[model samples]
Target chain A: MDVLTTPLTAFSQYFSKSDYVLALPMILLTVFALGILMIDLMLPEEWKRLNALTALIGLGFSAAAVFRIHSLLGPEVSCIPGFFGTVVMDRFAVYFFYLFLVGAAVAVLMSVKYLEIERENHGEYYALILFSVIGMMAMACGYDIIMLFIGLELMALSTYVLVGFLRRDQRSNEAALKYLILGAFSSGIFAYGLSLFYGLTGSTNLGTIAQGLEKRISANPNDPVVIFALLAVSTGLLFKIAAVPFHQWAPDAYEGAPTAITGFMSVAVKSAAWALLLRMFLFGFYPLRALYVPMLIFVALATLTGGNLAAITQTNTKRLLAYSSIAHVGYMLLGLIASDGTSNTTGIKGIMFYLLVYTFMNLGAFAVIASLRRREIIGDDLDDLAGLYKKAPVEAVLMLIFLLSLAGIPPLAGFYGKYFIFLSLVETGHFALAGIAVLYAVVGLYYYLKMANAMFMREETTAEPVKSSPSMSLALAICAIGTIGIGLFPNVFIELVNWSMSGANAATIAQLMH
Target chain B: MMPVATTFFFYFLSIIAVVSAIVVITRKSPVHSALALITTLLSLAGLYLMLYAPFVAAVQIVLYAGGIMVLFLFVIMLVNLEKAQLEERFNKQWQVALIAVLTLGALLIFIFEKGRSVFPQTVTNFPENTNTQVIGLLLYRDYLMPFELASLLLLVAIVGAVVMAKKRV
Candidate 1:
């Protein structure tokens, strides 16, 4: 009891000392989300497009706020306090806030045309996406487990609806039903785990939990209940990350959802999940490393095998990308497995850098997919993309960059992302896992190139030309610039990732050594 | 003392929960399924009461059994159920049943084998009264934010369901 009250009092004192400049991005996003919801309600049906525009304006302001906060805080500022220590304003969260805002902005841009064609364009659609983005931002900034769970559910519930946005489609309906049942089940399990953890630790704050775990482990290391609680928590996070055995819904959901929304899911949700995963594993469960490392390695292996092998046989473009995202998750887990005391910093930095690069390439690839629509046919199949270069040179070229980047070809953003992740693996002396990762990367590259070849090398089968909208073009351009820019000048992002990891490492070490 | 009666109550509620859950899955009529679910919900509430969470028990009965189940029944009736195609509502997998049985059997074995070691005997001394007031106090004082946010979530769900089910503007 004294423990909890002390933090509250100290937090209040901290808030009294601090200013609101650091919390500007979160404030902007919260107001923007509410504003968009209100505008959606107020506007007439004819002005529904205004909802999308509103989301864009809100996201623009959020991006500006992120930049402003980052500049003001520099690399060392720890923005804490506010909302009773629920939100942690720091470089790590600010980076993810920018990533999610940019990703949501691009998704909204792509949705404008796609929703029109599908006749599912409604204010609620844009409002839900914005709400989910807000949820992701909340999860990124959350400092407490209670806040984390709330943010997580906010994102999950909205996504369950978004996954089945096209109600007329039976596949979409089935996907939504499956997602809801499984997501709710996992959430229940997660909540149960959290309750147990809180009972044991006497607090739900991450920092406090870390301290408690360190103390408990040092006092008596073999408590079976602690092991069980850790397993349950890791299981819940694994479900969110779509790690093996829990990833049965991803392919179906991705294939069934709107393409642009799938892009948003692929990048934004994955990044947010990784952020929470990093915080939990690097803090709360660090003392139980012996238990988690093997479990993580096994999951990484299964995810890699499942994703890469399934992707090879996929005929649907969305499902292929779904599998590809799973494979990327496998690589991310490699970083986690390699995160021992010696190289924990590098592992986290690698994950951050990969997430940064992945946001651009994956979103850009889906943008091209969104652009591949005509009067009668939706471009969901690989054959639909046949001879895309002949139809739309710019879209095809953009897709080429995206595929190459995903394939980790040199001088592209994806290459650097892979390089950093693999470098971290090698540095941790996990040469065997690094080797397998490289081998799987080759397997992944084959399919990416197969798609690229189909686009560039094949002859035009259909006479109808592909059209690109201005919003989509702008999204693609931003993604393309980000991909190339990060590839050429990786230092700025590397520095930022290093700075974030340093804060996380210092906090982790402090708790552990105490 | 009514130790035997208490044991009987536990067995009776367990049977009720199991039977209703089965009915929920296997009943052909949607109305029957919904009613069965209400029964399951009620039995679960009773079990919660046995476990000394009288507040959750009441909320379970009122919120889930009364409100949500009624809403489910209403939706079932509101839709054109008579004209709707009545096909197999579940996956036709005979192997799945076998797998489920085997898995449950294995789980039972594992639990029986490890139960003594895994579950330490700890006596829970409850207060003389465990009711809605105590629960409400705890919720407001310790879990204030989550309780408030849960209401907000329910509000979102209400608005979302209305928007989703409504006809075009």
Candidate 2:
């Protein structure tokens, strides 16, 4: 009885502020999600394509809403109310929310053709993707550990189903089982860490946790529980990001899951996880730098070595890219480590910029792969890509741009992304790590170039040309444009990156130096 | 209730949790393994009660032990379990297991050695307020967004599960 009356009062209280600008995007996305669901249910089987169309519309509106909100709220505003203080509306979160929306939109576009080809096209697929997008948005904006965990699980559980969407396939089943078991295990570890943190800090909000850590560190200085709890939490996050030593499931899962969904997972999931990682580490655990920096550095090195070495031997293209992504994670971690000891915006900017560039090039690369045909004669082997240039010149060229970008070739988005990241490392005096990262980048170039060479240089084995859907062509074109545009006019993107990093750096310095 | 009985119960529950966890991992049949998992989860609920978090204990029993485990059992039953034909889906790495055990033992020793400096015993009374009440207040007041978002997560999970289990279009 009280609950009924209370929400009405709460609603009235919320409206009295007359400042719904901060909440407009969430409101828009929520409404759009429900609208899409309704449309999905109302549409007939043949009109199921409307689901994808509706999702695209929803995402577009949400993206526009985000821009409007950003404009209205300015850069560094926090609109927290009630007791929860769970959702934060700041530039840092807004940046990620936009990224999630764009990534999901591209993923939906990429899925259209793949789903059609596999004859597994369904409205639920689109709906689930939107749901996962909502989860990613929540995770990105979450200000507290409980919100983070719920959002993480929401995304994970949905992806688990998405991974095993092709139920009859043995590999898909295996992937789902592996993911479920490992995901549950990691979640349990994370929850235990949360419990430990709660025991020590008596709070779950990131800001409160930071305050507690500052106090505890000054008092105890060398308590092992502090380090243990930090390790456990980082371990859980590391699992999510698929960093080395915990990346065993990534390759198999990527190889087995539908290619389009794999693309979505690689970009959207990684971006969201990194967003959460940045928030947690930079905000909540900044005072414990001595505990995290060295551990992260070692993990980065291991991830680089393991990812590159494993990629060199991979026969399947998807698995190869999976390992490649792991290596990219290593590079991203370099940005995190570079942010240590100083409140420089360059390092964080580099990370954010790279994530932006990566979303395009990586997804574009996967789009090209999704278009390739095995022909039952030459499966998804390296040989299948032979003479792709002659068979499908447009795709081959687009694929070239993606591979070049990923390899950090000049005049491509990938190059600028790496350039900024390396610049940050050097600026932070992480010269040795940056040097090692360059060396690994060269090693990565080998495999990416191999794919490019196979597509562009090798002669066609079959007379039949590869066919692709118009939707895929459009998606690839968008990615190509983004990759080249960001590379050429990087200043605009650089400004955006700078703006996002300023908030993060200010918050980090304020908490750490206190 | 003597403190001795409380201590005994703690030890017994801990042993059961460990044993059940082991069984959950080792059992050949997925169904049997899932059942063992339920036992492990129940014992964990008991452990939660011992820790003075009765609300968490209740949640553990209701959500995990009752709700989630049932879903797991149902899914296991729904899937053609014959396909599993358990020859260990994962590679058998006894060496890694042995290494894990040894590492755990070493860690325990280190923990004991360091315990003196860190967790010095101080007799303190547990808070009088009920765990449920406190948690409810925190959830509704401090963690309201997360509480609401958790419902959203459940809604997504329900939608996703139905989608995945449905007949292909």
Candidate 3:
């Protein structure tokens, strides 16, 4: 009895009320996910769409909680380290939380009709999305490597299942298999790197690991252990973002998955990886910036060139978007490379802004493809998009907006994503990389115009009208509005990005103690 | 200096682990491969025990050598082994794979050789009797978040497995 009481007291000391408050968003999502699973059993087939509504409600609640936390903490005290620093609720985490919730909510909206068309409508789909949203939230807030890794696995596992959700489709099965195998391989490499870091630093906390890395760097400036660990970790993250050399899995996975899932994967999953990458590099591996920067430049160049070149040949719409998403990763990497060490966070801000904007435009583009799905036709080929304007004028116009934005056409939101990244690059004086990035942008413009040409110019092939469900239209409207709104009125969103970045810099951890 | 018996046993177990791991991959027969994998896992458990992590050793034996091996054997038995044996054992890109493997091996060797000095000669020792207790405390308290999140991971895996394996959802 004495032993049990002593251990219980010690365990109780590890948590507090604030910790639960800090984790309310994840808790709410988990509870909702479980609730959906439980309620799924009693629902009739006609009411299956209710699962999507529940998921959206869960995302809304999570977003409100994040907003409350953000408002309460404000800009001055940005970082709130909880659970003994395993997680942190900072401006960065808050910003990404909203981004992820929006991505998931929009995805849930898109998934309802798409899953029904696929004849795979089930509560598990919405529950899985919520679970993945929780994972993304965790990834955003994870202050410890263990937390980050678990979050990554949770997100990866859910996405893998979602990718293969269409049980009857052979392509879907193939895609999920390729994604699972490659993803598992990369995770192994990632774990190896993490274990090495733990062995070298004797700590899993990012803050402590940064300190340990600094000491190790001073002792041996060119230690191969540190280099190997950096390479391995970056490799794993690169695979997630679909960067070149490790991007072979992307086109297959994207092409094979359900259209809504492909959209979700392109936005939410990629953003979570971006969040993890930024946190790990900016917080834990900042000392090795000099080494990683050069490596990133080469990879970014390859990714840009490879992604654009590959997109030109893809007749399949999903495959084309996959390559384009990889190209977008190149631009984001440029932003990361240009982060001015400890002082200026212009590049980091640029990345956050770009991810936010990309979520809208990219998801909008995919939502259009999802809207085109009918009983007879899958509507994924460039030819399937022929005469979209003649059929569904609103969706066609909306898609035009998304494609133009994606291509970095000025006065559009997509241009601002590129603008911020290029601005950061120039600010840090990476003119060569910036110039190369511009060249790829032109190549990107060509393929995007190709898609637009198919929609507005090509003769109508299929006689069947497009299937634009209400939920899908709402998703498209949200995305289109976000894309146009950000493009036309960039100042407000720019200020938000600035505010998030100011509180998320290297000084964030220092302010945590107070 | 390490005791001769302990060092010898360490090297012996390591050799067995390495050899059996190679055999596990290289074997043509599925049953033989599974048996070799068991040998590898057992040797790894022995090595873990030598490192004074008795709990990890026990888990390795119970989970890998015992439980997973049964699953592996079942899978091997269920699959059409004769037809699998007749199929091409290697893909057409074996040459490319060989080159890639060699390059990776060389890189790893170079890294290990260069970073050898950074590794400490001795590891910090925990009280062997209290190893499990300390780990339990860490898992439940300091690592409470990840521990809880791991349940979510397992749930996702379970759901994913069911979704993939079930005939209909």
Candidate 4:
């Protein structure tokens, strides 16, 4: 038998040219992370800040590789499968890849000073973030459930250490343990779901699974195995995104983890999970939409209500933002519910646009918190933020802009993101759900403004002036511009998302035609 | 193929596994519990081999029984032994957890009933150790991406272990 005696086959059989070229980004990221680890050992303590630049350069190189792949694939939306079709360099992946890079860049910028403030400024921090971004890009590019699982584990494992990276703090240790326990449980459940899907379809490839499920569902509409798979898979991902019922770990984790890692979890992790969810629904579970959609509807409603109501009771600013993040997941799920996975631009584009908008808004908010979080003072309390206007005028104003945008004010990026989702929902005739989403958004605004009101309206609590480094300010500036720019000129970003997803929409249309 | 000896061995393994699992929970000393856990794991591996999955059985014995259980014992010993013994046996919410578990078990039975059409009772015969070759080829070929990505996860775990246990950042 060839298996017993033959030498390995040539690489050409399993890998296309794109596998090597498109893979350059992840390869370089890994090299950079390892290089930083080695370099950190040799560098004198005084020169440790150089790791940030090294990380930025690595990110820049990988982003440029993404662009090169984009040009190679051309403007026509196409899925250029590689790594034996387990991964694809498609416009959908490219979109998320770019967003992840942008989020990583901003997070690194925010961390530069904050790490020094907390006295945990190690090169491994930057290396870990880069590694986490690689996992996210893998999830975005994954066309196989196994690929997605590995990607999720890579991201989740890196983040667990990153959360507890503040080893000296007991709160950080507790948060890390809780997150690890809950996260591992969810991963187990997720794997169980994937196993069931594999058993039912006898395939792991998304395309093959889709084909198999469509035939099976046509014969038996209420397939218990498929419904259970949907429940298990969604539960696992919803935990990642910090949606309701599975969200117990989030508030404490967000409040305990170093501020920058919290922002990373809120943005990069959320986007990666959403990307996987979208892929699963659009591909493997397409025939069971009727089965899965009701589940999502119930989840979205509960998440919105629980997130806003619990947020209203939180005194810790970090905890409030945690709840707010949950509420945002609810809004994004609406877009998924509205889309039928055909050549529909509105729903997918809305989710993409909202994720991008959320990156700027959420990162900007955390940057303000980081600015105030110096050694000996963990200033993430609503009371501490009171009179923030007097302590740091620029931060206060930027926080106001960010919070208002998060609250979905007109002419801001968040409003457009929500509006697009609402538009899609109306088009899909989910008028009641659309109305509930809006009402919840209004309720969410109240809590968001409480932060703003405390900052601008309350008297000073301390005489301390919030000190922020140039790099942190630069991150804030980028976020502020994005929040305002996308808000003011919404069409540019919306059009870009539509163009990138054109390839995905085409793929979906072909699948529907089957 | 339907040997009485094999059937007798299967039931023996199942009974041992259930009894050891119960002992694992009931034991007062963590060391005793960990020992019981190893017995449970070894019996489960025997069950897997009897089900024609020799590779899985080997992995179960090697990873769970040998590697993980040792680690578990080490942790139980390393932690404050006196304080752990003094703490409550169960949490305040054990009753709620028990009720929830029972409900879940009932729901699973309902699901099994609903999907009974596909839950075939017969088991297929396979050539000895063929699953090893089949799984190896699958992992190395079509699932190569995830296979490699799994290595990345392990690397992350290693990094996490070092970062968490290290004295200084």
Q: Highest DockQ among the candidates is held by which one? A: 3
lDDT of each prediction vs. the true structure? Answer: 0.78, 0.79, 0.88, 0.85
> In candidate 1, what are the lDDT values of residues B1-169, reduced to their tens digit?
3333387889999999999999888877888888899889999998888877777888998899998887898899887766543757577796898799999999999978876564434555566274666666656644444444455455456556755566662
Write one digit per residue (lDDT tens) for candidate 4, span B6-121: 77898899999999998987777888889999999999998888777889999999999999988898899799987877777778998999999999999999878876576434
User: Against the true structure, what is each candidate's TM-score?
Assistant: 0.81, 0.81, 0.87, 0.85
Which lDDT tens digits does candidate 2 get at residues A1-514? 2221121023332322322444556556667767777776777767777778888887888888788756644443323222335665556787888788878888888888677656677776777787787778778777778888888887888888889887767888899889889988998888788777766777777777888888888887787798888888988899999999899989988888888888889999899999888888887787788778889999999999999999998878888999999999999898888875245667778788999999999999888888884333323567677888888889889888998899899999999888877998998899999999999999999998888778788887777667777778888887899999999999999888777666555555653354
Cα lDDT tens digits for candidate 3, A251-287: 9999999999999999999999999998888888877
Evaluate model 2: give its TM-score: 0.81
Clashes of each: 0, 3, 0, 0
Worst 10 residues of 2 chain A by lDDT: A1-10
Per-residue accuracy of model 1 over A143-204 as CA lDDT, tens digit each = 77887888788788878888888777788878888888988988888888887778677788
In terms of TM-score, which candidate is strongest?
3
As a TM-score, model 4 comes out at 0.85
Query: Could you tell me how far off, in angstroms, the CA of residue A142 lies in candidate 2 after the best superposition?
Result: 1.5
Please identify model 4 stretches exceeding 4 Å from their true place: A1-12, A509-514, B1-116, B119-133
Q: Which digits, one per residue and each the tens of the lDDT, describe model 3 over residues B1-169?
A: 5533387898999999999988977778888989999999999988888878889999999999999999998998899999877766568998999999999999999978876677644466788789988898789878888999999999988988888899977
Off by over 4 Å in 2: A1-24, A34-38, A75-83, A373-379, A511-514, B1-136, B167-169
| Candidate 2, B56-140: lDDT as tens digits | 8889999999999889988988887877764665577988988999999999999789766654344444473555776777666
